[model samples]
Target: MTDTATDRSTDPQKAPSTPPQGGQGVMARIRSYTPTLRVQRVLAMLLLIAQGGITVTGSIVRVTGSGLGCNTWPNCHDGSLVPVAGAAPMIQQIIEFGNRLLTFVVAAAALLVFIAMVKAGRRAELKTLAFVSGIGVIVQAVIGGMSVLLDLQWWAVAIHFLPSMILVWIAAILYTRIAQPDDGTATRQFPDLIRILAFVAAVCLAAVLVTGTMVTGSGPHSGDAGVGMEGRLEVDTRIMTYIHAAAMYIYLGFTLVVAFLLHRVKAGDAAKRTAWVLLAMIVVQWAIGLTQFYLGVPRWTVPAHIAMSSVVVAFSAFLYAHGRVREGGTGTSPTGSPVGDARLAASRA
Candidate 1:
């Protein structure tokens, strides 16, 4: 009669109870509450991907300078959520409002993931992450609205971008954790030195992203030209750009150093491979950053830069994750090579 039962982790040894043959009510109710791990995992991944993808679209809105196309929050213009045709060009409305509409997609993904976690009796860690994701979307929506209300001020736009980066990072963590069993034991793959390097790499990446936002705020694209550019960051765009680039250099430097340490320590091939991918993403992102700057922050490159930013952050997070435990293959090569399992078994023996 009560749906409020919380402890739902299925017992491996419990025999299935047979319901009355003619009336299957009890069995039907029991079946409804069982959580399928596969479905929950898939939903978690989609939420992670969507979190990053929406950030890219948001950049489009800014680079194209349609940030205020709808000119108001909660409602598009004055009285309605939909855009008023006479208030702005149809394309502008579509671009800005489209970004807003996608917010719903983010909300839906986060909601579904949270529901899946609770219903499946996932670990408290996973449930908390999913719940945070849903809450984050709400907070993001409010910040987005504030940006519009404030006329897309440089600071507002910058604030808006920062959270997307954070959510992407969290989503990556969630994706990584979902692969593990609900049992809360920790198994580390990389040694201490490598772990320190990975942590440094992550810290540097955060600096790089913060500086990158400053660079964006000082750059030509104001998200909306109508918004007074007077409020833009006082720092010279060139100087901020250089600072951003320097932070990026540090991030890449640390990541490469980690890769080197991975090799020096003769770590597992999976760890080495993940380190390589992380380094590659950092280098490619740096290239895009340089290109965007030299090309005068062209519109097309803005989205590219944003997209790569997301990719680099996600990759760095995943690398850090692999350092903790082998993703999906617990104690096995992330690349699914049998050697990882062999090594793990050997170590245990």
Candidate 2:
């Protein structure tokens, strides 16, 4: 028996102990709650949908002459929390009220995105995007109020439209960053042709938006005298409409070209898919634009056109962001490096 019964010291050859099952379970719970790149991407998409809905509803408010239904910011007529008895009846009040409710929803969505960004600790790029989207909602709300207060002045309305487009772009970036494959083979070097194509597409998009604003300002939707004050298309309005149509055609061409190049480069499945989506949106948008023009801006077509434009801008921006990232780079990491090529290679191995 010797000293064995009294020996309390541990042996040098003792194997190391692993963490307990309960400890591992806690770690798994922590990971589940942590915001990941995929979660951020999903949040961004949700925010985009909200923004698009808001844009469409806002257009409905204008197109239906419901903009003035409330007659005040943050309140209805007579300072009542709800629409008064004489205040444009129930249907008008409901539509206008619904539009107001959406603004709050959009704001709430943006706040959630901001919180998620903080949780995704390592993805600085996504964090910045969420911050921008959050700030954009606030600015958009302010601009929107001003539009109503100013009687929907053309410039104020146009400014309000611009932010929605920016929000769409931010969402697209978030989408691309998360969806990009982690393979090390993505080329960092962008072809000059691709860069040129992106630049042209961006220019075309801006022109289309500006011309659209002009067209709206000139049309009945602007709450102004439509087309002519005296039986002829007002010189100013006519010119603007032509410019808008021209810009639409140019945008259509640019989008098709981008789709062609994207296919030519074989720029991964994600990029190709995005390009195709953009092309489809472009086609649909053109059809709506034409229909709106020929139909003299039918009530239904107005919101439809606005909604389609939102989608087109979002998809186009996705294509642009996907193209900008060096072929293999994740764009999610702090350094924008091709995140851990060795890990990807090891996974393949």
Q: How many pairs of residues in model 2 come into backbone collision?
A: 3
| Residues forming the 10-long window of minimal summed lDDT in candidate 2 | 224-233
RMSD of 1: 9.5
Best by TM-score: 1
Candidate 2: tens digits of C-alpha lDDT, residues 1-349: 6465344335434545454479786875554444545665677678889988898998888777676667667676666867877767566677777888888888887777777656444246666777788888888877877776776677777888977887877766765664444333444324678767876987899889877876786677753222122222234766677788888888878878877877777666766787788788888888988887777788899889999988988888777776555344444442222333333333335
Per-residue CA lDDT of candidate 1, range 1-349, in tens?
6333332335434545555664486665544543355666688789888999999999998887788898988999999789887898778889999999999999999998887666555667878989999999999999999999988888888889889988988888888777666543567887987888889988988898899889888878888867657668878999988888888888888888888988887877876887888778777887887788778888999888888888888878878887776244344222122432333344345
- Listed in order, each prediction's TM-score against the native is 0.83, 0.77
> What is the alpha-carbon lDDT for the whole of candidate 1?
0.80
Candidate 2 residue-wise lDDT at 61: 80
The lDDT per prediction is 0.80, 0.71
Q: What is candidate 2's CA lDDT for residue 226?
A: 27
Top candidate when judged by lDDT against the true structure:
1
